[model samples]
Target chain A: MALDQSVSRRRLLQLIGGASVAATAVGTLAACGGGGSGSSSSGGTLKVIGVGDQEAGLRKVLDAYKSSHSGFDFNLSFAPADQVQTALRTQLGGGNAPDVHVVYPGNGSAMSMAQLAKAGLLADLSSQSWTQKIPDGFKGAFQSDGKTYIFSPGSSMLGAIYNKKAFATAGVEPPTTWSELLSVCEKLKAKGIVPIALGAQTPWITQLIPYALVPGTVYAKTPDFDDKMLAGQASFAESGWVDAMNKYLELQKKGFFNDNPNGTTYEQATSMVATGKAAMAVQVSAVLSAFRAASQTPDDLSMFPFPATDVAADNWIPAGVVVGIAVSAKSKKSDQAKSFLDYCGQQENLNTWAEAVSCVPLYGDAKVDPALTLFLPALKANKAVPFMDQRWPNAEVQPTHFAVVQELLGGKTTVDAALKKMDEAYRKKA
Target chain B: MPAVLVYAVVVLYPSIAGAGSAFTDWSGIGNAKTFVGIDNFKQLAHDSQALGALRNTLLLTVAIVVVQNGIGLLLALGVHTGIKSRMALRLVFFAPVVVSPVIVSFLWKFVYNPAPDAGLNAALGAVGLGALRQDWLGNPSLALWSVAFTVIWQCAGYSMVIFLAGLEGVPAELHESAMVDGAGTVARFRHITWPLLAPAVTINVMLSTVGGLTLFTQIIAMTNGGPGYATDTLSTVLYKQAFVFGKFGYSTAVALVLAIFVAAVSFLQIGYLRSRETAA
Candidate 1:
């Protein structure tokens, strides 16, 4: 009987301990704006789709809007990033689209602005003042031929987010030149370290490395590379695409990347770098939060530009406007939808958003915290280039990128063949 | 009438809509639809992912139906010979089928865990079988088979039970007379028990073949049809394109192909199996 009582008491203690821990975690997230602050309003309801972790930040603005406007109310729902776009499409297809939403094209993301724009589902917020604040370079992510549709409140830039500790062991500063980067890889390999944690298993992730590296090539060529190519004035085979693939082949040839990259998935690659088994990763800026959690170092990982070439260095940035909020053009209350875009530009909302998602803001006037630092070298050299696969004329080009990467890593196709295949695929799209 | 209307509204209409939209670029919203003739189908035929998924799905179906039946028949023969703990054995065999596919996937995902520190690998290392350790989900060559094995392992017990039921209904006098004629267990199985177990075979093969075709949750929860289209089934590719990419129009076309493929293949298999049964 005593044993039973003691066991029960122990179990009770454990339950209380776990509950307290969970409460604290929830409290911390809530303090950051997870939820519970949206004020009640009486106006026709506005539905917002976002993440639960981001609810705290969203609620600050949502609650204020609801409270101040006695005539309107907003109902917010949270979904993981992968679920948002599909759910939006389904709801829209059924004629029940949400008032506002978040979007992720997902791995090898075939989701494009073209699909949204062509369908006329996305609203034209071309009239919004914030649109002008966007750089001439990044204006196309939200717009196709200079008309705005859906609004992305923020975006995640792709780059080499390196482990500082890994750099220290290799006795190399983060390489800023292509030659230095190769030397660094050789040095790391000599020390029994895998210089690059490449994952071809996801196929999409394999493409991210090349995509991140292509910004410099775009800069070397000019900002109008995509437009020229899309308009039939430029050819991919002529662009620094050949050079980019050559660099990738060089990395493979040097034994710089992990063995059997095709055998590794996105998670495995991330784990490799995070666990300090591998030195660096070429991925999106959005990976900071997840990378921090994975490595248990929410602070150590930092971003930088890939060391392409000197001429390319100045133009090597891939930036896309992401997660913009737009009112539906078909919406009955166009005025309300317009107001939401205005709200997105507000200082508190901007701060809440950038801080919440750990994203770099699109606007120059928007206040940025010094702690949310990214690759200053890369940012200075290259501005945000558009996400590569998104700019493809046909959706067919997107899946091609995923496949060629796998082929490259699998050793089934050489760099030349992959590029040739890409041209063939793109030409078909044309 | 209301129920019928609800079914039509909820299920039948969408299905027809999906099939109809396969030839068009509908994107999934609004009324504007563009008919592009066979562009989407041409894409599907060359869609490396879709084609790979179709091949993988068929591979899984073929492997599962064959292996699942083979194991079920073997179990039936053993269990029929009046064994102790027969009920306990039956319970153990049928246990996995009662668990949900999600749970089954999760359980075997842990078993197939590629990391050295994982449950299966650790056990193998412990048992001096470390040589057999594999990156089950990560290896392109092995992932599909690993996923197929998980599905087969889970459902094979149900197949066993069905066959056991068929075996019970078999006349014991015939088996005894065969034994009196000096016919061995293997020969008896080939001639007598196997011929009688046709109904069970038909049921198991048909069900398992369909189960393999529509496989989603386990693949989704496990390898996600990856290491690069390694284990992709038609369902996963359709899902990734429709849900993840919002290329619902393209995805619906893929779904049409899958529907047609499953229906046609099952129809053919049913005909072949039934003919074999009649011949027996």
Candidate 2:
């Protein structure tokens, strides 16, 4: 009986020791994590998460803010575009989101401003001076229910980032009409250059060509197409999107695109144009820096609006507000985060961020990237539309568009079928 | 009692509560959930994407189970002999089992690069087999098989290790007795080794079955369920629903169904395999 009691006592002591060790370990981890967790204004290091496209501008502003503010500090990290949808959204869902994070400008994406603002996950920036300065046309990108929730530097132009040397080799210039574009492609192809580098394997890349086309094919003809779609008066299948999809297939059928485009990636496509293996890739001006970085002669690369129609007057461009940052509504450092966003809203700071990202400044006559010069006349003439997905009612339509495009590219689906699928996805609940 | 309480709090509670979300229209964030009475499940039944993913999942699982185990058995038999390089071969075969699935997926992705002058195509060209080269992951018909090959490559080693352990446990006395009875190599393997390895086969098959059913990491790292949903499995569909489509409720329903399906399959497989073991 005595031995049993002694053994029991020893076991009790061991349990106590183990519990203590575990408690200490927990304490240590918590203390380590404390540095990154949202904290009060005085000495807190605000955590910031951003997507790769936003890194150049977001990092510049953050570094500037840190240098100027005596007490301000930040821990900044960037996620690739695909991971932002999964990893960062998971963080947001779990309610452990960073104080500041990247949010796409409009409603279509899962990580867009409208969706997050509706979820009550973004802090309101309605009272900020820059919010007041936002143009009426672009307000939808920054606001939800008449309140601004995101701060974007400016709009990114969607067009072809073309290799100047490749064009020179083919003795061609940037095309202004669909026929001219096709003729130019034929010339480039004859010159032994892959006319276009399409990387449909990258999900986001699949949407760019269609986005570049639809601004003219769909929106230019029906200026209120988004409203008509919202009211159920228009659908993808019965609209000009069929023409755009046909043109996309026409390019493929003519062998204008690199071989096995569905197998290639965004990086591969970028390098193809950069190295003169391909003449151009339909891409956003936000990625011009990436194209330039890929090229040995950065000056060899420039942008031109991707022509969608034979009529030059009807070939409008797509210039949507680039991805921006928002203060998390649940952040403990909401004020600090808001202050940083407010700082980002200043005219000079806005220009700095916009210039870094190769986008047009939101409210200023700031000197824009030279590569974007060809797109200015369209922007000036009010012949530009926000990206089609930006006004989509729900997140489902965009991914549907991505899938159907791949299917079209792989000869697995017809243009009619692809548009039908997109229309079905569009009709789903937000 | 404390350990049980801890398990209840840490594992059981979260799982049960998470399962409850399958019945609602919770968008995965915030407190705005509506109890829609299994609407998600009803919708899932009609979801073409989910159905397609189910078909892909079953195909992947079957391929992994049959091919992975077959290759593993062959590898085990080859290396279990009195060869001078047996240990080296064993180490080489099992090396991939220790690496991260994400890393392996990335490596294989490089090998599957679609360029004619790069990766597998280049190697094929070097061997005068250029005509055999094809887009490994981008082609809709080939993508699912490409992913299956990657999973098998990484996991066949794991099966080999398990079979090797079973081989170690097999007694030399049985083999000696069979040989003394004038049994040839094939006869000895059929009557002695194969019967003795039943438990190992059961274990390998069960583990691979579960692994195949829930395969996620490699697919996400490599394909992201692309090229017109050719490579999508149930796991990717649920993930896309919750995070990508903002339909957490539907995602949870998928997770619940997948969990139930896996459990049912495992129980049936274990029962059959256990009976086989007993008979052996």
Candidate 3:
């Protein structure tokens, strides 16, 4: 009993000693983590966070800003596209948001404008001199309660990017009607070429074809379709979404896509079209450079609107701002970040930024890239509509669309079944 | 006192706060939350995707635990015998565990590609088993199993080292005596070696159960719980709901369910294994 009591006493002392050490260590760490707030360095350094190719483009813009304003300095960080939203959201929630960040223009995407504005995480940019320069089409995208919060440099069009040389080899013209598109596919198939390169392995790629087609199928006649959806008067299943989805499925039925599109990655799909193994791929303008970079001859590639209807006159292109820059409401460097935004708003600066990302300049007077000249006719004729998802109320709906499209491609679900799933997600009270 | 303070500040506080938030409608942004009073849990009960994810989680856990342990024991047994190449072979088997799970998943993704000329398919074709070639990760039916295979491949070596330690602990004299008494290799292994491995088996099963239940990186890297939620484990579902959808409250509720499940299942397994260890 005496021995056991001594052992117990020793163990208790050891535990107490260990605990005190842990406490001291934790306290030291806490002290180190909580440093001085002396200088307000936030005002001196403009921190910007972006993702994907946007990083390289933004870095160039920052360099230009530095040279022009010799005393200005900035910090920039980049993450993978998939991680950017999560990283930014966590930072904002922790009250350490970057001074400037890349946010999607509308509510449908991750890091959407509306949600951030609702959270009061975004600074009101309505008073900024550049706010007035925003086009009518884009003004509604970044506004909440009639107050602007985001400034986008440009917009991107989603369409069928084809190898011009491959088309010439197959003797098939870019189709203006749905049936004509099928006939072109048949011709391309006979010439031993994949008609369309679909990278369904990347879920976002699954959404692009449907988005590219929806303009002509759903919104050409019903420009108020998204409005009806917001008012709870319409659902995806009851609207022209079924038509767009059916057109998407028809390509699968004809065996026009590459074998095992669900297995093909985005890189593979881009390379397939770029190398002329496939005739075309329905993708966004943002990836045009990626495709070009993979091509032996970048000049051989061009884009055309993906037609969803038989009427050539009714065809429309899907277009939307790819990403917008926003100032964090918590930033002490709001003025400095706004200065960067101000610099971004200049016509020359906007043109440089837009061209780097292969985007259509938001300003009408800005010089357009020669490669984007193909989209000019549609834009000038008012046949290009903003991406349908841009008008959606929440982020969840876009991913739901992606999964449904993947299911449709894989022959796992019907158009109606898939559309019903989308409608269910749309009606989810976010 | 310091330990308690640290625990209270870091682990206990966050856990209690997280549990509290599970009952609210916090969207993980700004301080807007309303107490929904178990509504999130009720939604989880009705959420087909969440239920499906739970089912996948259970299935994946079982598959990984059984397959990983079986392969590990085999490798351990092989290395235990006096083979000239045992050391090198043991090193080879254990190598994969040191590689990151993300890289492992990515490497396996290429190997399991469904294309005719892809790694596994080409190997099958070369072996005249072309009919067995499959869309390993793309097919809904095969995707869960495919990801489970990757998980098993990465960790089987870890399990082997544990079983190896247990095997080393078994008395060589006992095996020699049993052989002298006319015991065959099978009989000796069944009666002596198997019973002696109880502690190692217990440790392995518990570790595997916990790891399998909380699997996220492999699923995310390979499938992203995709091909239309065919492989959505609870962790992936929680991540999507919280991070992707911004339904942090609902996601936390799902996370709470997952936590309860992991704890209950792990407790039951450990109890059963411990009882077996005592009996043996």
lDDT of 3 by residue, A46-106 (tens): 8899876575457778889887775678888887666765778889888999989988776
lDDT of 1 by residue, B219-239 (tens): 887766666567889999988
Which residue runs of candidate 3 sit more than 4 Å off their true CA positions? A1-45, B126-130
Choose 2 or 3, whichever is better by DockQ: 2
DockQ (Cα-based) for each candidate: 0.26, 0.67, 0.46
* Model 1 docking tier (incorrect/acceptable/medium/high): acceptable
How high is the CA lDDT of each candidate model? 0.67, 0.87, 0.81
- TM-score of candidate 2 restricted to chain B? 0.99
Report how far off residue A150 is in candidate 2 (Å): 0.1
Please report how far candidate 3 places residue A326 from its true position, in Å. Answer: 1.5
Q: Is the docking of candidate 3 incorrect, acceptable, medium or high quality?
A: acceptable
Q: List the candidates ranked by TM-score, beginning with the highest.
A: 2, 3, 1
Question: In model 1, how large is the Cα lDDT of residue B169?
Answer: 81
Q: Residue A421 error for model 3, in Å?
A: 0.9
lDDT of 2 by residue, B84-126 (tens): 9999999999999999999999999999999999999999999
